[model samples]
Target: MSSVATASSGVSTPNDTRAGASTPWRRVIFGAGVGNALEWYDWSVYAVFAPFFAQQFFDATNAVSAMLSTLAVFAVGFVMRPLGGIFFGWFADRLGRQRAMVVSMAVTALGSLFIAVAPTYPSVGLVASALLLFARLAQGFGIGGEIGASYTYLAEAAPARRRGLWSSSMYVAVTIGVLLATVQAAALQGVLTDEQMTAWGWRIPFALGAVLGIYAFYLRRGLPETTAFSNARDTPEPEKQSMLRGIWENRIAVLRVVGLTVGGTVLFYTWAIGATNYAITVKGIDPDGALWAGVIANLVYIAALPVWGAVSDRWGRKTNLVIFSVGLGALSFPLNWLIQGSVWQLGLAMSVALVVHAAVASILPAMFAEMFPARVRASGMALPYSIAVAVAGGTAPYLRTYLAEAGMPSAFTWYTILLLAVGLVVIASMPETKGKKLE
Candidate 1:
């Protein structure tokens, strides 16, 4: 951010490059943000369109069961996240961060394209469902790799004092992606007939996701390697570069990442994704209403991200994490119960929930990155965080649906509360790294 010049038109563009720096910090943030956006944007596309996908992929059995079955396939992506993290984390650790992102983006694009072109259940039978699962697994692998690499990139590239503000781009861009998915789904519901949406209209969003993934690849390829990564390249012994060896050496830091992420992912998925599904299935709100609620809440969430990050910069990361854990644990049950019926009810509930979660989402990348040195940063961040997402965030919708269908919706609420309590304990036990320079 030193001596950066801006446009005469009063708005800077990506073309505005630094005169002497290797790469402008703004450009680095933009490139990293774009990759994060594509990852979560594709993720929300599936969540927003789950109902349409369920109809197209399964025979007309019990409607709820079919949707749950589809979500189980959706969980397949989550199931692969830990493995993807292991692979991609090592790939990033060995190769450059930019190179890892380019390949990850392609995996997402190909997977999305596969889904966009998949046939209906009647046309291809169980094979259609299999294709859907394959797509999710591919996307899962892509995004799993995406989070650790991208987060490490941002944390490494930013200036020391402003790291939290820069890393907040992760959630700022991700929330924009979430909002786009909801807006696209809402527009489709409003513009298309139900039959049209169920038949072919549902494919438009996935096709668009494919296109964004390609663009993300190009953006990432242009990014220069982080200074930290470049400097640390020759320091580690050859065998230490093996991800398993690094993870073993930094096992404590990795476990802390997992613990910190468990409550945050549960809150994020529950509010950002699970709430939409609940609004439609449990409360019987129309698709349009649920989607619109998602859109509004996500818009608000995007704006709140950097604000929360700034707060964490002053108040401390552990403080924000504690607030997030307590708020979600205390509020989820009542807020979810109050989210029945009207659009205002659902929208208001999600917006409030998002306010609490934005703190965690904004501060998390910086917090995790602060835990380890550049050599093990990517894998240390990825593996533990991915495991938490798989266990808490990925299966949240299915678990909520399943529990509700089994006539025990409150059970899901209690389960979430239990996890948040565990996260709170971890937060209390963790070292506060506010303003601490990355190793």
Candidate 2:
């Protein structure tokens, strides 16, 4: 946006523009990250609170069955993500990022509010389950689009040299959001009796998420359009083409997006999201203890994020991802086996896994953003990434539950390993995007 351009290592660093671009990158990152945190805050709370609330939504033979059913509904939210991505990506690509993000946050807030006040199975029979599903669908759609817009904005707004370090804010915000969810649940557990939690206490987190979304909306509303997007928006088209056709022409990049996400999302949701519950269920840890495990582990992961992100800034994004894929693939089973013990074991396993996962999580925004030009960046990244999450990450918890009930939780470790291998292949084939100029 500015005449002052940097070609250090052939990278074109973003410069401030007077038209609509904002400077001092910290505000840009904070504006984008806050909304993302609220979206994930609602998402994580559901998974963590499922055990207490599952009975309210389903009639089942046992607690496990009820929890499994709730998780299946959880997976339902994921199924809607790709559709959300397509619609919202098209909107963001055509209109503006700020509009797309604000609306997504509002819709997500509405979904959480619905869950906060949903009736129980006894009060409304199967209708209660239907309400939960509807709420999740709205959330899934909102969050699906939230990712594409937020990542694109962060990548575009940051200085080129420090992009990796700045972009890691997304995961940092997510870890904080997840930590808050766990802590809230833990604190509530202390204050309320189990019967009270089952009856109504589970709703507090969702209610709180809805309020947080309001603040997120307020922060994001004032963000100026990024110089990258503005430049793309202002340039004359070389040839007239539909956004869908453009995306179709870049099918390989789209597929690469899916490949890039498969392992990261699977490994992330399986261990990061599912581990806490796994501790309570399979390992016989107390619920509060399991919640505390999640809280403490996320705190450590949050602290380590900047360190790994800076490493990717100097070393390479591909290097971190390769380490992530190889480490997770080689160690999933051993880690799974290790966590099959006490609260300390669960905390250790989650922290170790997240520390490894940080290699990918910290660099993913820059990696995917670098894959596509600014013209179609949001749409290109959103569609395929959403599809991958829907297929892999969305179902990880449910698949683990199903396999565990079938007496084969260890089998999931092998499944994760196979996908991580595919990710490694994708990573190896892709060029090193470190310091590569955004097209």
Q: Pick the candidate with the highest TM-score.
A: 2
Task: Give the TM-scores of the predictions, in the order they appear.
Answer: 0.87, 0.88
Q: How far is 129's C-alpha from truth in model 2 (Å)?
A: 5.0
lDDT of 1 by residue, 37-121 (tens): 8777787788768887797888756679879988888778888888889888988887867778788888989999999999988
Stretches of model 2 off by over 4 angstroms after superposition: 1-23, 51-72, 118-130, 237-240, 404-409
**Consecutive 10-residue window with the lowest summed lDDT within model 1:** 1-10
In TM-score terms, candidate 2 sits at 0.88
User: How many angstroms is residue 268 displaced in model 1 relative to the true structure, after the best TM-score fit?
Assistant: 1.3
How much lDDT does each candidate structure score? 0.80, 0.81
Q: Model 2, 178-209: lDDT tens per residue?
A: 77887787789889999999999999999998
Q: Which candidate should be chosen as best, given lDDT against the real structure?
A: 2
- Give the range where candidate 2 is weakest over 10 consecutive residues by summed lDDT: 1-10
